[model samples]
Target: MGALFDHLIAVPILLPLLAGALMVIVDDRRRPFKIAVNLVSTLTLLIVAITLLMIAGGMTASGDPARTSVYLLGNWPAPFAITLVLDRLSALMLVLTSVLAVAALIFSLARWHRAGPHFHTLFQFLLVGINGAFLTGDLFNLFVFFEVMLAASYGLVLHGSGTARVRAGLHYIAINLSASLLFLIGVALIYGVTGTLNMADLAARVGDASAENRVILEAGAAILGIAFLVKSGMWPLGFWLPTAYTAAAAPVAAIFAIMSKVGVYVVLRLSLLVFGPEAGDSAGFGAHWILVGGMVTIGFGMIGVLASQGLSRIAGYSVLVSSGTLLAVIGYGTAPVISGALYYLVSSTLTISAFFLLIELVERARDAGADVLAVTMEAFGEDEAEDAEEEVGVTIPFTLAVLGASFAGIALLLAGLPPLSGFLAKFAMIHGMFNPTGLGDGLPIGAGTWVLVALLIVSGLAALIAMTRSGISIFWASIERTVPSVRVIEVLPVLGLLGLCLAMTLQGGAVIRYMDETAASLSEPAGYIESVLTAERVARAPSGTPDPAQGADEETEVAP
Candidate 1:
């Protein structure tokens, strides 16, 4: 058991991979058993995630950052082998993804899991790819994991057939396939120039790469950046996001809140690693474009929110806002800004996930489509309706009160209003925008920083105004507003998500500290490289190439 704990990094990937495969073999008639497998797997993943973070933070029984886990596959050298390394950044992502998996899976159990075939299988595979992407240290392996994630997503995006879903799925599939092609092309160019697919090796080689190779690397980086930008929902390229997300079932959309962030994660990981201080003239190769593009993305998303009519569209635009803000923070590339942005990332993701789940419940009362999912009042496990049989009264009842309360919390979070995590996150970001030192001696706020500041405020205001309008339209303006019948399972997941956000708010200091540390670790890549390139890391890894005496029996399956 003690030894097993040392190699825990691989479990996030393996657990999901195994579970998804088993789910594929399980017949759909075994619904209860399927749900059990999914629930147990996701819950266990949540546990593993927390453990990985604790281990990284030195909060576990083994206490040291040097003890941060690295697993090399095939027992090959780092430059040639596949590797999965869990640093502060990757560990943080695993924890986040797991928490979301638990919430989204529980929410889906309410009904969406039964809506189509192999929903459970696809979901677990999605997790497998996402976890693998976050963990892998090799760029080629990253591509493989990306394809797995995308392939799974193609099925998920079309899980429940509708004309709109089919249309959106087709567009989504086409764009992503093209993006994948770009991703492959970029990887090929990088590998051709550098002769290594391992990210650590790439970083180690980049600083000293030849002038001609630098040109090749730059082009490869540009092409790769396009793929990431498209995935992250950066302008023009992300027009498909709103439509696709809106058409997706509630639970799918809820989980997809993290999809855009995956692109940001890759860019953040690769950019600083490959182009940091050690990279000489290329130290900040693409920073300017990222800065300009992030601002433009924010502007585009804001406009979409203002012009949107429905709740789903508004939520879709919010993804853009979240993505743009994170992209801009990455562009800023300051430790402090990245710190605050990390907190903002958590706050906004949980807030939006809850909002997506909540939207289905709220819309069920207003739209006939939602009514299709409606069941008897007893299905809610309540003796009676939250209100007096939908007859409005002077005093608010359980359903009304809950929706109102959740609405207020979401509004505060999304709008960055006071007392909530959203407000705290934005305040931290705004305060750190210039990194003030003394009364007259703060880091001089740059013009671009000011622009970011203005956009932050404007985006918050746009969100506030839009949310308020939607709330009134759904909650108050409708003279004959029917109370939505929500199941406890469905509502519990939303509450769990929002509660997590609130908990993050209550414990902002520790969380922010972790984010700060994670940012610092990412900003400097030396330690990360050292951890991956050690001889033990490459020559003695348990999962990759085996020694000659050990033979094929010792070797395990790795992605070809």
Candidate 2:
């Protein structure tokens, strides 16, 4: 049973991998097989959720102490082998990813069946890569998982490949491929200097390196950071995001909601581990740069959102804004701030994914062709039609009303209004910035305080104004044509995602606590290193060279 728990580390990745392969093999005509695959995905998600709950419970029970779990592939040791590791942070992320994956799958069932053969296969493979990326503990393995996810995403993104989608997909592929190359080069450099690719091991060793070696490590880390930044849709590097995300199919774009987070996850993990306070004076270097870059990203995204005319593009810019804010919080480098950032990460990802889903629904309903005015007209027509049909009152579907209300709520939350998860998350971060602790007071008293204050005010205002504009355009304006019916597939995902955002808002405390624990674990890298090395060693059995077991073990360890 204990050994089986170790296997739990790999289940999230393996289930999807096997499911994808099976999906490819199963005839499309075999409805049962497809149903089984869906069942498998749902069950896999349930397992991941249960596992995370158990882990979170354990962490809470232990008084929030750092805990680690190791899964050794083929029963070999690490360094000479590979391993899988899970901690608070990775567990939380895994659960989040699983939830989103299930939602995405459910959303796709109706529409994606019409897409083509092996659509499910591509989706499952993408999940495999995503789950693998979240769990793995090695640097090189991270790149591998990234490639896997990117490859899967390429197919998914270009699935329908209308002219616009194809063009966007090409741009997405080109940029990400370039980023991947940079990632590889950075990894090679880091390996050259540190002689180790294990993240935890690297963290332990990086602090001890000579000054010159530290310089090399920082340079490598910077390059790696750039790769992640591009993925996260940070300023300058993220021009490809809006078009790519906007042009993707609804369900495909929904999956992409998890995509940007992968970059944020890497940035959060690497920054906390590789450049933590323990890295001594060198730690501050990357932190300052991230902070500056994040601020710039926020400004850029804000301008884009305010100026954008299309709903999809607006949503895309919103993603950039959310990413920028989270990154900025991370740049602050305090435990409280990180906790806040983590909370915001959860809220933002859920909310934005929901937002995107809603945008798709609205677009479909209005036959709006992604135009802002068209969406507005549909909403208005629906409202007017309801008024006209029933002298007493036309009964709008409670689901539709709830969806609209939820979008409005999310807008409020994004604006940092009180009594919402977004506000709480931002408040927590602001609190951390002003009152520094273990994460350090990275900013100056007068200047930093003012800057943060300005950001808070500006961000809140920007969100408010943008939402107001979008809301008026979507809900109040008149439509020139009859609204189209929304497909069940699209509606289900949007509702599910919106429900999640609402739940997060209601359960902010629990979410914050989970994030706090996760951040703490990330700040302390010893347990992660031990688990990965332990698993790797158990898997390899002194193989003297990298092999399949080593690869598998490494893959498992990199999940978080």
Candidate 3:
């Protein structure tokens, strides 16, 4: 039973891969099979959630004061073979991924066919890649999963293949492909320096390396950082993001919200583990650069949001802003700050994805296909008198009204309003930044403090103004046309997502506590390395074989 549970680490990544393959063969004409796939995807998500709960419970029982799980593939030894590590951080990310997956799947139910053939297939594959990226412990494997996800996303981005979508998709592909190249180069360099790919082992080796090797390591790390930054839509590197995300179908864009976070996850993981405080602060390489980068990203995204006219584009830019804010929090490198960042990550994922979904509905109602200019023109025309009334005072479907209100709440929360998860998340992070604690020791406060305060004020104000403008355009501005009727199925998914956002806000405290624990676990990598390597060697030892023989072979190999 214990062995069975250990293997469960692979389930989150494997189930989606298997489901994706099966979806390709299942007759698309059969609605039953499609429903089955959705059910299975939901079940897979449940399984992941259960696995996280178990991991948390085990940590409680161990009395070891650390929460970590490691699964070696095919009973192979770590540092020599692949391993899947699930700590508080990875488990939390897994849960977040699964939550978003289930929500996106539900949202796509009615719109899947309309999205194009093999919609379910692409979606499942995307989930597979996402889960795999979160679980894998090898750097190269991470790149492989990233490519898989990117490939699936390319199809989803250009799913309908309109001119705007195709153009945006091309831009997206070109930029990401370049990032992939840089990723490969960086990984190759890191491997050359350390001769190991496992994250835990790399962290151990990086900590022990000489100053010269450390320089090489940091250089490679920077290159890898650039790749992730590009993926996360950091300023200047993320110019393609808004166009691409806006051009995607609504359900597809909802999934994309999860997609962008993968990069942020990687950066956070690497910064804390492979480049701990000792190494990072040695040459001013700690979280300072990340803080600066995050602030710039937030500023640029806010400007983009305020300036954009299209609802979808506005939502896209909002994603950038959220990503920036989360990154800034992570860059603070404090337990409280990181915890708050994790909470924000969850809140932002749900809220932003819901926002995109709502934007789609709003665009459809306005008869504007990612064209803000056209929608704005129609809003003022006398021919759209009925639509104007519907836009402002009309009776929307109950579900849609709920969803709209939910989106409004998310926007308000993101702008740092009180009584919301977003506000709480920011408060925790800021508290950690200004008033240093044990977890926050060694973090530079002089420059970082001023930057954090500036970011808070500027981002909050910008988000408030942009969100309000968008709300007026979407829900209040007069329309010279009749809006489309909201579909019943569509209403259900939107409302479900909205409910999730509200729930997160209501339970902010508990969630932040969990996030804090997760961040602390991530900061310490020794437990992970020892568990994986030790368990793997024991599991792989031949039945009835004496330990001395295995030890002799390893000793002989290392001696000369």
List lDDT for all candidates, in order.
Answer: 0.83, 0.74, 0.75
- Please give each candidate's TM-score: 0.90, 0.87, 0.90
TM-score leader:
1
Poorest 10 consecutive residues of model 2 by lDDT? 551-560
Off by over 4 Å in 1: 59-67, 368-393, 436-444, 535-560
lDDT of 1 by residue, 1-560 (tens): 25577578789998989999998988989989888888899999999999888778765446445444677676665555678888788888888888888888988887888889999999999999899989999888899999999999999999987899989999999999999999999998988888777888788878888898899988998899899899999887788898988889888888888888899999888878988878876788897788778889999999988777778888899999989999888887777778888899888999888889998888877865332222222136434356556655566558977987898789889889888899988888887776744112223687988999999999999999988877765665443457878889988888888898889988999998888788778777898888787636323446675464244344432222
Compare candidates 1 and 2 on lDDT and give the better one. Answer: 1
Residue 92, model 3: lDDT of 71
> What is the TM-score (0 to 1) of candidate 3?
0.90
Q: How accurate is candidate 1 locally (lDDT)?
A: 0.83
**Model 2 stretches astray by more than 4 angstroms:** 29-32, 56-66, 367-400, 438-444, 481-484, 487-489, 530-560
lDDT of 2 by residue, 1-560 (tens): 26566567788788888888877878877866786776677666668656755764473344655357766555555653455667777777777777777777777676655575667788888887887888887888889899999999999998774799999999999999999999998898888788888777777677788888878878888899999999999888999998999998877887788789899888888888877767765665577777777888888888887777676777788788888887777777677778888888877777777777777666565544535544445447444566554445535455556556766876877787877777887888887777666453445556755686578668778878888776665554524323446666667766676677668878877777777766666666666666565543333345467555445544433221
Writing each residue's lDDT as its tens digit, candidate 3 over 1-560 gives: 26777778888888878888888888777766876886687666767666765575354544755446777665556665578887777777777777766766776776654557777788888887888898899898999999999999888888876899899999999999999999998898888788887887777677666778777777788899899999999888888899999888888888899888999999888887777754443423547778778888898888887787777777888889888887777676777677778877887787788777777666665645434654456467446665555456556655445645866786776687777777877787777777667464546678767877788767878778877776665555524344546677766666766676678778866677677777666666556667765653444356786543343335311110
Give per-candidate clash totals.
6, 26, 3
Model 2 residue 222 CA deviation in Å: 1.6
